[model samples]
Target: MKNFFKIIIIAAFGVMLYPLFDSFSGNGQLNDLASFYAQKENVEKVNSANLVTAVVVTYRGLDTLGEVTILFLTAAIIAFFLTKQSEVRTLRRNSEIFQTAARLLIPVIIMVGVYIFINGHLSPGGGFQGGAVIASAVILMLLAFPNMPFNSKLFGLIESTSGLVFVGIAFLGVLIGTGFLDNAILPLGTFGELLSAGTIPIIYSFVGLKVGAELSNIISGLQSVQADN
Candidate 1:
């Protein structure tokens, strides 16, 4: 009976997606709307050399915010579940060589993560990717030093402050610019420069910090559960 229901669901999903596949143009040509967005004049409006970044941070800012919120909620839920459990499990320590390597590589990973988010508007990387990189560094630390002290309060503070700043910037756009999450809240500056792309760099910075902290908090919470067991 369960297999029957699963097959039905799969069939339904395939049926729903069929029209989208059918609508694809056979000719290898860009759609009119896509071509317009790709045009140099349209691309220059956001002052971002990366068109994908311009579309994400400027054109579809709210949608990106929704994605961030979803990630934050997932981390929060993981923390909550870990807290509810009373049993603690001990984690095995890594070898000395592994620990030493982690200690050496963590700083470099963090620096790369920061660079990725900071230059999001000018390059291909952005806050989400950078935040994941930062979180991976924290994961490595957790693995190398099982008993390493993690300050939950500090992580929470960082996450909260960064999220507040992101939202505040969005509201500021309402006050001074055309709409919420408007990149025009700050000066566009020279294209391709470090200081370019108006609020995009600032927004991505806060987002990267917030995501990194949230993920770290989740990992720490899970580690605490293991420690208690």
Candidate 2:
């Protein structure tokens, strides 16, 4: 009976979504606006080779800011719940081999994460992916050394500071450019270079740091809850 109901629900959703399926059909040609944006001259305006990054960090920056806000709120809620637990509990110990591997690998993982976000404007990887990688490294530390002191305070500081920096740059954009979150606030240097793309690298760097710190805090909070259990 449960399986019957599940199938019915799935079929209903499929039927409802069927009309939108035609939206995916492409005629193998760019529309007028799409063609304009796809031109090399237009792309060079943002000073980024990666069009997706250009869209996310420049064209739709406010949307990205909203996403970061959601993550920060979620981490705060998780931390609040974890702290409300009545008892302090320690996690079990792992093998020395695992601990040593984690200690050695954590820095390397963090460096990779930093590199990904720093070069986001020039490359494929960006703030969110890099931040997830950093969070994974924190998860590794928690699993390898369960009793290791995770600094929630430090994470909070980093998160807040980065968020502030991001917002400050956005405001600067308003003051200098066409409107809020404008990428033209800073010089769009030589295209395809590491220092190019105006405020893109700077914005993405803050976003990466803020996201990584928030995710690390959430992981630590969950680990604490698991320890208590």
Q: Please give the lDDT score for candidate 2.
A: 0.88
What Cα-based lDDT does every candidate model obtain?
A: 0.87, 0.88
Q: Residue 155 CA error for candidate 2 (Å)?
A: 0.7
Q: What is the TM-score of each candidate against the true structure?
A: 0.85, 0.91
lDDT of 1 by residue, 1-229 (tens): 9999999999999999999999976978878977877888877767888888887877888888888889889988988788834565556667889989999999999999999999998888998889989999999988888666788889889998998899899889899999888887788899899999899999999999998998898888877776442
Q: After best superposition, candidate 1 residue 41: deviation in angstroms?
A: 3.4
Q: Write the per-residue lDDT of candidate 2 for residues 150-225, one digit (tens) a residue.
A: 8899999999999999999999888989788888878899988999989999999989999999999998888777
Q: Cα-based RMSD of the predictions, in order?
A: 2.9, 2.0
lDDT winner: 2
Worst ten in a row by lDDT for model 1: 84-93
Quote model 1's TM-score.
0.85
Pairing residues by index, what is the TM-score of model 2?
0.91
